[model samples]
Target chain A: MSPSPEQAAFPEAFAAALREPRSAIPARLAARPGVDPAVRFAIYRNNMAAGLGRVLADRFPVLRRLLGADFFAALTDAFIRQHPPAGPVLLEYGALFPNFVERFPPSQHLAYLADVARLEWLRHCALLAADAAPIDRAALAAQPPDVMARLRFTLHPSLAILRSPFPIVSIWRANIDPANPAVVPAGLPGENALLVRPGLVAEIHAVPASRADFVERLQAGVALGDATNLVGADLTAALAFLLSAGILTGFFPVSDDAARRSDPA
Target chain B: MAPRRIPSLSTSAVPASRPTPAGLSPPAGVGLRPPHFRAALAEPGAVDFLEVHPENYLCDGGPQHHFLTALRQDLPLSFHGVGLSLGGADRPDRRHLARLRQLVDRYQPFHFSEHLAWSSHGGTYFNDLLPLPYTQANLARMSAHVAETQDCLGRQILIENPSLYLTFAESEMSEAEFLAELSRRSGCRLLLDINNLYVSAINAGWDSWAMLAEFPQDAVAQIHLAGHDHCRDADGGSLLIDTHGMPVADPVWDLFAAIAPRLAGVPVLIEWDQDLPDWPRLVSEASLARQLAGNALAEARHVAIA
Candidate 1:
């Protein structure tokens, strides 16, 4: 029942038609004579684009509500046309939508949209990341100094830290929850925050600038002491903050022989 | 290419304990969502199966996982995938396939199914079930794709017919003919959507009855009933859109009644994604399907007795 080898060329052409609205065989095929096929095919194209646009709008509801419906519609259309889906899993369709909004010309006025999108994307990533049991705090405390040195701490899979200039949390809260004490902090300042799923819910919290730099270094696998010094005297506070947040899961200590082999000093 | 071997079985993804599919009756079941998890669990045997979207549970642990676990304990479950993109021109997505296989192993679902449309191409995902033109090229491609999917998942997958918006002038065959061909070529079963048949038929100006007649009933394993929306074209002509928000229209129900007699006890599922009613209301909608199937069975019995 499969199509013969001779008929296998239709898929390429069909794929093209699905991509470009006006790129199919002559419109007259639907109804002959230099008649307008656009009017007939236009409905299909409109429905396809509009339906997909609405999907993006829904996925990025906070973004849409901020940008207003009409602007979001135009942006969604352009994004879909330029970047059609590569697979059927639409759960990830808008992975780059936030970046698209940031780079979009009309959206230059709304500066915080991209950061908010980044936060949403990270939230989605955190939600789907591999689940890990919370690290054994008691075990960490019991390890000797030398054994702990080799330990490479493993952060919870659901942890993501974001730094943004705009008061994105405020904006996101206002548009989504509304009644949560609206406080629009002074103009867009450099902001750092973490998104972690401790239980089942993804919680977002702002991290101080020093803690952001320290955690970034720790996440890079630097020695604990060296990573601590990265934040000066606040190293203890930063490490405690991250540990208490349940972001650090477990550590893999380096073997003594391997440590000795790498000891250049 | 030589038919690739199916993946080895894994039990990590399926429920710890599940009854094998044996002499299972096609009892009425409502599409399971988070909102009704409590009510669904409260009433034992209220429904026969709980169908969950596998994509929603791809996460390691979350509210979605919590509800599915709780519901899995009390009822038989089915894994319905919305993102396999099995009809795409390229090969099946390996990562998506592995994740799905893992979930199947964990859940040990009684049945598994996916849509007959492609949602992704080139790296971008559309999130909507986009239709394919029924051409020889597409049929061959889809058949291979379905085979590939079954090979990866290590089980037979039922492919549901899609509700299309437009027809391609270059189509070499009807949608029903294409599906029939794919089923034969891929060795996969069919999940016929009578509502989709009616909707697509109305949208593309095809004869609904003729299309249904052409459908490969022998391959059918399940049936889907859902509501659709109506839109007017420039000429004021009506277009029935497969929106899945409203209640089943009367004409679609009539079509189902007409076709039910021919099918050999296909499992029926009522899907209401958008404008969802209260749990009882949705249960009532599924009850109607059970009622109709019951009536058909009774009529058959009467014939035998007579």
Candidate 2:
């Protein structure tokens, strides 16, 4: 016979105690009569605390490096206790960590840390993202002008945009790349990043703030003409960079009626 | 959330035909890590086969898959899962089952294995493998879950004996008996981890070799050899922790040497997951495993193998 819901409570209690240090070892777990469960139970505790700390550390190398080991470990303990992994694919773990860092009291002083973490997470995602085919320029050219205006793009699976009030691009570069000794400037100039993996490696481009509006609109699946109109300055370079970067997977023209349905009234 | 449906990379990634290399008899396998991708490809015959944790390759497509696609053309592959909590009180996650099945169908590896221990409960996956009590009810739960996994995978998977730290008072049967019955009931095979048996037996105060003598060897389909760490318990008593971070300790190697005769022709994997050495060093460990296993098979047949 399988465990009854009452019996099933045993593992539930065990898992609960694994997360909470204060809880006594599930009363049923045993060693020999003289042996204490504390020593054995500590292995599972360390596995969750230290094991998960390593996972989070691996995911955010730049953040870990920036905060130093002691601080990272301190923050990571709080992070793991609150956000243990929901599934087995560890690659997908730590998605909410950036937001956690944003609210985390200790990291609040390092205002740029969250965005840098966000950037690293994107790079992590890009490392394992699916292969995709970019839009065919020749095929796109054959479409009518009116149809092209209302067209929306299907971005690559790995594409992500991060806009921050701090110079995250320079911070990420200075810390991560060994050869690139480019020092971060003193003034906190806001930066926007365009991230997409062209092949095996994901590339980060620091985009002009003026074009941030255009990128945001397009990402929201806004029509091409409308997205273009949102930006005042010339977008020739930005458009070229995006088109050449393998960011757009495909494109489709949305009818006015369909567009309205997608948007809120 | 629904598991995203992505295009299958198998048809696109893998080559139509893979070349088989002639090698020394009875292969030794090594866990393929990112650090050794280039070396594995550069010298295909260095190790006879490669094993990977399927969870690491769960993504859609990338360099790891890129290299594996190329390496598959040169050597055989095995998928050892670390996440399918078959010993959990609850049923296996259908989404995890589906995703794992997708890889199994794509790779078509000869050996697939998971631990008898449960690593997830109440929807949260503990990164480390956790112990399962060996009660009749727990045994029934594990058997059903294993059957469900096999039915979904459409292939036989091996269950490994986890390295454990403590015994459960709730357990009504011995771990060996539980594993034997699990295989008998689930119609699955075993992937015996020699290091795990050594570590667990010592930690639980049982004689390691005596437990090995009682173990059900006929059910084994694969073998794993790894290292453990020795530490003092709170009471200052000796404790063995299965870290898989160190080189195969002398005792484990001795255990493997002793048991290799019983497991002739089985693929042996050297699993060093942490503090990885250079590729050449890891391959040497694989070579040693191959030599020990090969020598055993040779003696059994009374024929020398080069």
Candidate 3:
């Protein structure tokens, strides 16, 4: 009763059949009697394409709202067929969809669609990312000033830094939450933002070029002294600002010996 | 001077006891969706029970958990799992089952259910229920997996029939026969989805009623009714797609009315997964089933009165 080698290979055949249209199915499959295998097979193809499309839409609601339903549906179908689900979870299905839309021939005119999708994706990631307790203010206050220079900060799992050529945050906020006013300029050069889950809510923090660079350095686990030099060499002001905003969650206590070995400078 | 204060939740709250019931039959219930949580809680009504997917409640403490907790207090619960992968040829993923069991222990749902389709193969998770070849080998594998799941949870589970689009030439037995045999071998019950039966019947050119008639009557514990999309095949032939949006079609309701009397008051749920409507619309759909159930009860009472 074990499935033969041919039977085990059905999923591969199924995946192939899904990418091609009904007209593309082999004549031999259609010639089968009674059940009409071609007819049966087409239903699955549609389901596979439509199901993936729905998952992508769920991941990027603002993109769908902005692009209109019909356009997003077409783009989603194309992306899903070209790139089938790499994981069993639909939550993990559309990791590359935003990038796909960016380069897709038909969608090239809508350059900002991809950035809107990225914003939605960052929100999704923030929602499902692992939970961690924010750094206690008392712990930071307790650390001696001498050891503070070597503290390597750990960013929360939900933190994501993105810079886009369009004012994507305004675009996303305007479509999804209309309480915020629409982007008056409609088109603008690159804006930077941080996506983070502080409580249960996912918040978009609009940071300046300076803060973004500082966060990038700390995220790379660069020691405070070196990271300060990399960003602007004004550690005191930056540290005070980040701590006040609750942006720096926790810091790894790197001893003087370990710090010296890691950073010979 | 004010006393020093420490921030803490109610860490000393004692865990509640969970009640487990025996046998197959389920009470009438509604599928709990996210949008309907407020309406469900605010209104006063008699929905015999409620069911939810354990995957949606995986977080430790969140809004979803809060809703599930509130609903669990009011009605009997059923933990229907969507990601268990019981029919996968590979070993049943223990982590998924353990998480489900943890929910079971916490909520102590009256019933637990999963489908008889493989969703994961070679580590690629399709997330959609793929058809299984109803051969003896698959039956044996699924039986063992079901037994393992039941043992892990320390309770018997009801396995639902899948909605199939294509039939494999390699399948050795009909789906009903295979499911009946699986129940016999694995000590599991059945969750009969009436809409799926109708959809599969139309697509595969089989008798929907005959399919249900063949299923083991004693093994069936619950029923599902949902809407489907009607489409055409490659050769312009008719096909019914099991898309769980929209209202329950007329034919599905007719089938439920016909088969319900025979099953002796099995719990039926109205499932709408996509394009979800407002609370009243979904509730009205459930209300239709409740009306049917009420009619069945009235007829039974008349027979007793006679």
Candidate 4:
């Protein structure tokens, strides 16, 4: 339905007030005798900026801490103006914040900030993601030898593989937990983080390049043998890590179904 | 007050299937925040019941879900919603309604409530409960949306009057009249927020007590008390902001005291969303509300006997 002129004007004026610092209150709004429309409008503007800023801070605490309060507040204000939340769920509100940081001019010097933000977002996602029952080792052990090669594993719903060019995992851990203050030694390379929520607690594990590649391949729906082939010598260790971390939720035999339906060419 | 007539449609349409007495009793509670979850779970009966914003607990799994599940087993839950946008141009979002339904089904909360304001427009949702023009078109839209929300949840939901900073020139009806008509049309109840009434009264230059007298007391299913920030307008007059960051202001408490007796057996919630106090502090506020409610009930009984 088309909006009533009042309905149409109310949100438009309110939204403009929220976005622009100096926007006049729409003509339709009546100011109390003593109150200026600008003063009244500022309350809403402050609420929009501060509310979204809080959401960003809650999701990206380490980043906020690193940037300090004022800088973080200004950055979130700019981000909120650009992208007010698309929906009511604050849990998923800051998906683009890390990307915004990547292109944000003032923060360019801090090369690792975006990656750290990505790690934080991943952790946030892992925390709220659905719970999944881990695959039992005995169930996997019961699979026939011929079926093993064709098995395509389903990772836990909360599992996330994040690869960053900076030593983001250490930075994230150090910044988030004061006890484990990250001391970045010189000449350290990039890191890959494996995020998982086996139970209610979310955990982040650092993985080597080979294991990261293997996990990425598995995430891309590669079968067991194919994924293992991509990792070469790291296959055994990666599989052990996956199983131990309760990352694999279930698996299905892909080639076995085709093999049973027709003779191998 | 001659036992203000319960709207006949409300009595006939709303089901009496709710199993717990939580829906029927006047228990003072506080908004359940994450910081106080441990204290809340440890002593569920510390207050009469607990109110939580369903949007905060919409996630599939987390410590939030875990503790809330445990808390539900003890105290009755009130799924007060902040995101339904009932007065928006469009009907309530189907996806959000479904999520609310899932929560209602799981928790069986004794009360479900949403604001009378709109928060979303076109696709973007402003985090705040944005204001609405009380025009006939807007009223029709809001009433239909409330009914739809009630139908979706399969229970009567409470519509909260928003704390307004500015009034629209096109508003055709007073907030009380709009809310009363909405309750009549949609078979929904009211969540009369005392803080909001006080703030909006001051901000809009209306008499707070007179506004309370006009409010549909019989339809009030719950009451919300919160603290607001006092600011100075351009002309140096007092401007009240519903910050929900402090203790209930004295005037608001007075209004609650006056209104409490009229709306007997309605749950009162102390809402402190920002600068949240310690668990004991919030519990103390709830205890105060309980005392006030108890006194009001007694006075109401005394008047009835006399």
DockQ of predictions, in order shown: 0.30, 0.60, 0.28, 0.62
Best by DockQ: 4
Candidate 2 residues lying further than 4 Å off, grouped into runs, are: A1-9, A32-34, A135-152, A178-185, A220-226, A230-233, A251-265, B1-24, B234-236, B300-306
Residue-level lDDT of model 2, residues A40-72, one tens digit each, is 888899988887798888888778778878999
Model 4 per-residue lDDT tens digits across residues B1-306: 544333232212211212232222256788999889898888776787788999987898878888898987777778889998898876789998998899888888878999989888778888898887888888888999999999999999999999989888899999999999999999999999999999999999999999999998878888999999999887888899898999999998899888877776567899998999998899899878767766765676778899
lDDT of 1 by residue, B104-194 (tens): 8888886789888877666656566766667777788889989999999999989999886655566778777888888889988888888
Candidate 2, residue A113: the lDDT equals 87
The lDDT of each candidate is: 0.72, 0.80, 0.72, 0.82
Give per-model TM-scores: 0.81, 0.87, 0.77, 0.89
Candidate 1 lDDT, A1-265, residue by residue in tens: 7855424433444345656876853321232223244554555556558767866875676777777778888898989888776655556667888888889998877688898888777877777676667778888889898766556666777888888878777667667653444344456566776888766677777877778777777677666756666678775677677777878876656455564455322
- Between candidates 2 and 3, name the one with more favorable lDDT: 2
Candidate 3, residue B39: the lDDT equals 84
- Compared with the true structure, the alpha-carbon lDDT of candidate 3 equals 0.72
The true-versus-predicted C-alpha distance at residue B214 of model 2, in Å, is: 1.6
Q: Which pairs clash (backbone N, Cα, C closer than 3 Å) in model 2?
A: none
Clashing pairs in 3: A88-B125
lDDT of 2 by residue, B113-196 (tens): 999888899888888888878888888889999999999999788999999888887778877899999999999999889999
Model 2 docking grade: medium
lDDT of 3 at A263: 45
| Model with the higher DockQ, candidate 1 or 2 | 2
Superposed model 3: Cα runs more than 4 Å off: A1-12, A19-35, A65-71, A102-114, A131-156, A177-187, A215-265, B1-26, B41-48, B56-76, B88-109, B151-155, B168-170, B230-238, B261-265
Best by lDDT: 4
